[model samples]
Target chain A: MKYYNWGIIGLGEIATSFTNSFQQENSQITAVASRTLSKAVAFANEHDIPKAYGSFEALLADQAIDIVYIAVPNRQHIEHILKALAAGKHVLCEKAITMNSAELTQAMTLAEEKGLILAEAMTIFNMPLYQELRSQIDSNRFGKLKMIQAPFGSYKEPDPSNRFFNPDLAGGALLDIGTYAVSFARWFFTSQPKVIASVMQPFSTGVDEQSATILQNDVQEMATVSLSFQAKMPKQGVVAFEDAYIVINEYPRADEAKIFFNDGTVETIVSGDSTQALNYEITNMIKMIEGETSNRSLFLTKDVIDLLDQMQQNWTN
Target chain B: MKYYNWGIIGLGEIATSFTNSFQQENSQITAVASRTLSKAVAFANEHDIPKAYGSFEALLADQAIDIVYIAVPNRQHIEHILKALAAGKHVLCEKAITMNSAELTQAMTLAEEKGLILAEAMTIFNMPLYQELRSQIDSNRFGKLKMIQAPFGSYKEPDPSNRFFNPDLAGGALLDIGTYAVSFARWFFTSQPKVIASVMQPFSTGVDEQSATILQNDVQEMATVSLSFQAKMPKQGVVAFEDAYIVINEYPRADEAKIFFNDGTVETIVSGDSTQALNYEITNMIKMIEGETSNRSLFLTKDVIDLLDQMQQNWTN
Candidate 1:
């Protein structure tokens, strides 16, 4: 059994969570890096990692690191990803992979040319509960699907200095919580929506604070998604069919789902390792590193990027 | 105490329910009319109404009627309302009162000219719980209002001959369940929205089967509404604020409301006569007829119709 060595770029909060997921696995955080040497050393001590570097490029240069996980600011992902790929490292970047599809396409082309796997760390696709729901939907278990409603939001005070309200960092609801709902809709449909309509309101700091979107396919299947930095929600996704409907709460790391039938009874299905949801993605990343790609089936990073781009265009126009 | 007599223009299912709401009131259904004499006679006999007319004209001509409750098809509302005003009777019409704002303007103008009350029987505005919510919102009980999400939908098999799928009757999800959500948004904002974005998917019968809309006002207050004829929903409305939020289930006839604050304690408020939700509308209609205009506050019948029209236009474009 081959162990996968990992290097993390940008010692952010998400990077710590991703490193923690490797505790019981065939992967280890071999190296970590930050903009300053002291912070990188502190993070390395915190995680008990082998190496610490003062910059992302120094971390990428470590030949023992098979994959580099980028958890930097949203607008900087593409640049860091390209640098990691150039240093012959497989990359697993955080969600909202890049600013737009054009940049994503360029990064994907680089990864393809280098024969390296590039994936977005969207844990929902690795969730067992979401997988089961998709399988049931594909097998006509819920009958004719009609509509889907997904909402993800949180109330954040609009501070001008916070990254969430900073326009220079590409901070907005669509790039944060909105991406999950958009990806869920695309996965459920398994096809690009024919129509995308959206409206966005700006925060006081000039970033898109809240957005609502509607996606419809040729068969009249509809999906409604609402995301905001102005409210906190229960974080549920509802998929409706002719005879029954399914509601999945905490959809991003969904562990349980309920099916409400027209007959007035509800069937609940519980799955997914909630405490270790990130482990699934880590394991899949290892599998891809070993040339076994089956676990990467529903990796819709590019499609989600495209959909968000379309929705933003719709909102702006 | 003088009793008010009602003349129903269309003896359909809604008319039956409206008449049922008068069980404990200062009003009585004196006459009923339908396009066919047998149906009108059967409905009148079934409801214990005194007089049955074969045509709407006959019901409108009855001088014994103090008001004409027009529960006819959407396309016929304006015509019947005008005729009722001409016959000197107060008009209480079912929602989606007219095809467009122009028609509604003509009807309201005629009612004002004749000194008659022309009200749309939108039950949400009359429900005590909804009124309480508006008052709380007005007084900033929930803090600075951020976003509102309201959804109403039900699975209805598309029978082309059914009124729900018929274009001649001006039928669609927008005119049916969407109207309530639109009215709710309008009533909450108290100001017209600056942007209305929407998407609609048509049924096989060429009427809009599902619609999702986002309405945003000048202060960045946003409202999202979804309606469908092909899905079942929980029929809930969420009003989000800076420090707290409230969820209203069965919002049109809401009897229970839950307020969740940031301090992790939830406060639930239960009010309104659920069993007689429709009676509130009847009671208010009676008050409007008896010169008490306070109950008519937030009578945004024209505004809601205009918003729906704008949303439909946005969906088409």
Candidate 2:
């Protein structure tokens, strides 16, 4: 087994939860970096990480760190990923990999040229239940797939200081909750949609607080995704076929799925433990870094970003 | 108690189901009509109706009938509704009142001019559970409402002979499944949506098999509705507020609701009996005809039709 040493950049709230993935034997959070030395030291001590760096560059220069997990704000993702790549570190950046398709392409191209594994840490793509659903769809378990529906929402107050409501931080529903819903559509369809139509309710920050999008491919496969920061949503994802449908509740970290057939029979599927939902993606990233497998998440991340970009463009036009 | 004697205009599948609402006291299906004499006779005999007419005109000519329920093809709804109004019969037409908003207006105007109780026979609008949910929403049981989502789908084989795929029959997902979803949005919002966006996948017969729509009002309140004839959907609806949400399954005839709050407490609400879900709407129609209450379903029906019409126009342009 190849051991993976992780150095984390930007210690935020999500970074704290992300440490759960390092609770395994082969993976360890060796270092953590924050702009404030005190914050870095506190995080390292709390998480049992060995090294704490006061600056991101100092953490990048640590030769013992084989990988860097960037947990910064959306605007800084590209910068941090590029800097880490320059330092020859494989990367697992957070979702909304870049602001637009062009930026995502630039970062992905550089990673490819350097022969480094660059992946987005979108946990849904790595969930065992999601994978099983994908396999079942491919094997025609539900007959011909016809439609998919995914909705995600969270009641975030309109506090201007919060990154979610700040336009300058690339904060909005689309880049955050919307990405997961769109990613599910892309993964299930395996083709870029022929048409995309969307509408949004803009916030005072000029970012969308609520938006609905429709994606339809040439094969007649369709997906409807609704994203909001104004409501408490269940975040359920559904994939429907001519004969049956599969529903994944809280799909981003999905552990359970329920399938209902046309014949009135119901089947429930449970996969990995819910608390360890992030472990599969971390292991997948390690495999990508070890050259045992290419990063499939990279391609899906690009598709999702491209679609969101096109949707926004369509809305404006 | 006032008795309502219903006259049916068409002997179709929906007409059979509509008769279920008459199972309660103070409501009776006294007469029915079909173009074919044998069908009319067979249907009336099967349902134990007192009279059967070989032609729609004969049914309308029946003086004892207090109201006529139009269950003809969608394209024929406007024509049939007008004729019933002209005959001075209060009317309860099946959903999708007309081909478009213009036709709906014409039909509703005639109903108003005749002082008849004209309404869309949408079961969800009258379901007891839906009424309770609406009351709870008004009472702020879930706090301020922010979003509403209703998705309905079914696996309809694209048989050319079937009305579901016949453009001449005004057949499509919109007129069929989409109506319920759209009506729910209109009922909750109580205002014409300022924005409507949609995308559709058409069948080989040139009728839409699936559609996704987004409707938003001025208060930033929004609803996303998805309808399909290509898949088997769970037909659940959700109303989300700042602090809680209510979920209704089998929404068209919903008898149960589950309320989930942010505090991890869940409340399950059961209203009318599931088997008699249609009775509430039938009673409401009777009340409407008795002049006890004006038909609220008419106004909402018009709003929904207008929104669907605008979405199609937007798509084509």
Those runs of model 2 whose alpha carbons end farther than 4 Å from true positions after fitting are A24-27, A314-317, B1-4, B23-27
Q: Candidate 2 at residue A183, lDDT?
A: 86
lDDT of 2 at B92: 85
When summed lDDT is taken over every stretch of 10 residues in candidate 2 chain A, the lowest stretch is: A190-199
Please state the error at residue B315 of candidate 1 in Å.
4.3
Q: In terms of TM-score, which candidate is strongest?
A: 2
- Least accurate 10 contiguous residues by lDDT in model 2 chain B: B190-199
Clashing pairs in 1: none
State the lDDT of candidate 1 residue by residue for A176-214, as single tens digits.
888888887777775667446687888887778888777
Residue-wise C-alpha lDDT for candidate 2, range A1-317, written one tens digit per residue = 77778999999988998996566677798999999999999999998889999999999999998899999988899999989998999999888778898888888888988888899988877877777777877888888878888888888877976889899888889998888888877888857774467878787888888887778887778888888887778888888888998888888887899999988999999887667766776888888777787777788888889889987886677
- Cα lDDT tens digits, model 1, B22-133, are 7645778899999999999999899899999999988887889998888988898888888899899988888878888889899888888998888888877788888777
